[model samples]
Target: MMERTALISVNDLNIDVALRQAALGDRVLDLTPKGFDLLLFLAMNRGLVFNRKQLLEKVWGYDYAGDTRTVDVHIRWLRKKIEADPGKPKRILTVRSVGYKLEG
Candidate 1:
């Protein structure tokens, strides 16, 4: 008899917050608390665009008074972990002159 496994799997490539706790191939991602939260937020609202200011207010909790580089850094980090090629990503997509979107 073939044994059935209950383990959840998110494709053979990558897994983000929407993918949950599932096998995501060979890529292993270690996220900070803030990074995880940001991923969760984006994953939950896939296909929707969110500006850095909006993300800061919603994810970071409160309006940011400093440089918005924090958002850019986290986005880059997330892309590195989730995208097969961070240079040309499919999941976390950047909207020109706007913000970012999580592609489903």
Candidate 2:
């Protein structure tokens, strides 16, 4: 069996990405594969600024030839689940015109 590498903990939430298990404040969060990947990438690189192109290359594992709207959509979805207030996000934050960063 392969060892699971992605381990994430946020407050009461503990998620094992390899096993696809997420516990959020005593409740289990249902996350899609893409969502899980995105969250794991940001959490692992906490406090680092990653532009859309970088995210596309790293997370998607190649240059995304598709629309960049995909990044925005996933970010929105991630914020909805992770942020206490998506409008005023304290975790995943937008860097104005630069990119997005995971706030530490």
Candidate 3:
């Protein structure tokens, strides 16, 4: 039997990640495909730090040839949609020069 995956919610922000549906809430936001994938990756591994390269390989596919800035851009986009204050993000956070971690 195949196990089913349920939605993952970050209740503090009233956000839900519907993995099978590839959506953030009751409806999908205007996030790009990559943005959704990036958010999904972080949400699935909440609180775990992942560097740009790791994210690219895991989320964007190992054959992806983009630079780390791509990850930054997607993270920025995610913040805008999910954060109450994008400037002072309370969810996804930077680790100086290391990378990022998702925290609710």
Candidate 4:
């Protein structure tokens, strides 16, 4: 059976992420194809850390030839839109040397 996609809100951020519409709350988020894919992946698997390489492969649909730093760049953009304070992120967290995890 096909499941309906619903809005995903983490914490009390007052924001809703609808993967179908690629939106964040009432405001439309202008995310790149890769950026959106990354966010959706993290959101679906919230609280679970995935390393850069893993994210790249899963989201990019292959083992990317690019550097893992791409994940950091996209994370930075996502925070600017979703995080209360992008500088000190709460929703998307950096797990030291491991990877990032969505704090759902």
The prediction achieving the highest TM-score against the true structure is 2
* Over 4 Å off, model 2: 1-6
Residue clash pairs of candidate 4 = none
For candidate 2, the TM-score is: 0.83
- lDDT winner between 1 and 4, please give it: 4
Ranking by lDDT: 2, 4, 3, 1
- What lDDT does model 2 reach? 0.80
Give per-candidate clash totals: 0, 0, 0, 0
Per-candidate alpha-carbon RMSD to the true structure: 5.3, 2.7, 3.3, 3.3
Could you arrange the candidates by TM-score from highest to lowest?
A: 2, 4, 3, 1
Tens-digit lDDT track for model 2 on 26-94?
777678888877877887788889888888888887956987778888999988887799999987899
TM-score of each: 0.75, 0.83, 0.79, 0.79
Q: 23-70 in candidate 4: lDDT tens per residue? A: 545676777777777777888789999998888889886847988888
- Candidate 1, residues 4-101, lDDT tens digits: the string is 53332233534444434322476456777787778777766778999989989988888568677799999999888788899998878999989998
Which candidate model has the greater lDDT, 3 or 4?
Answer: 4
lDDT of each: 0.75, 0.80, 0.76, 0.78
Model 3, span 36-59: residue lDDT tens: 678777878888899999999999
| Off by more than 4 A, model 1 | 1-23, 26-28
lDDT of 2 at 9: 80
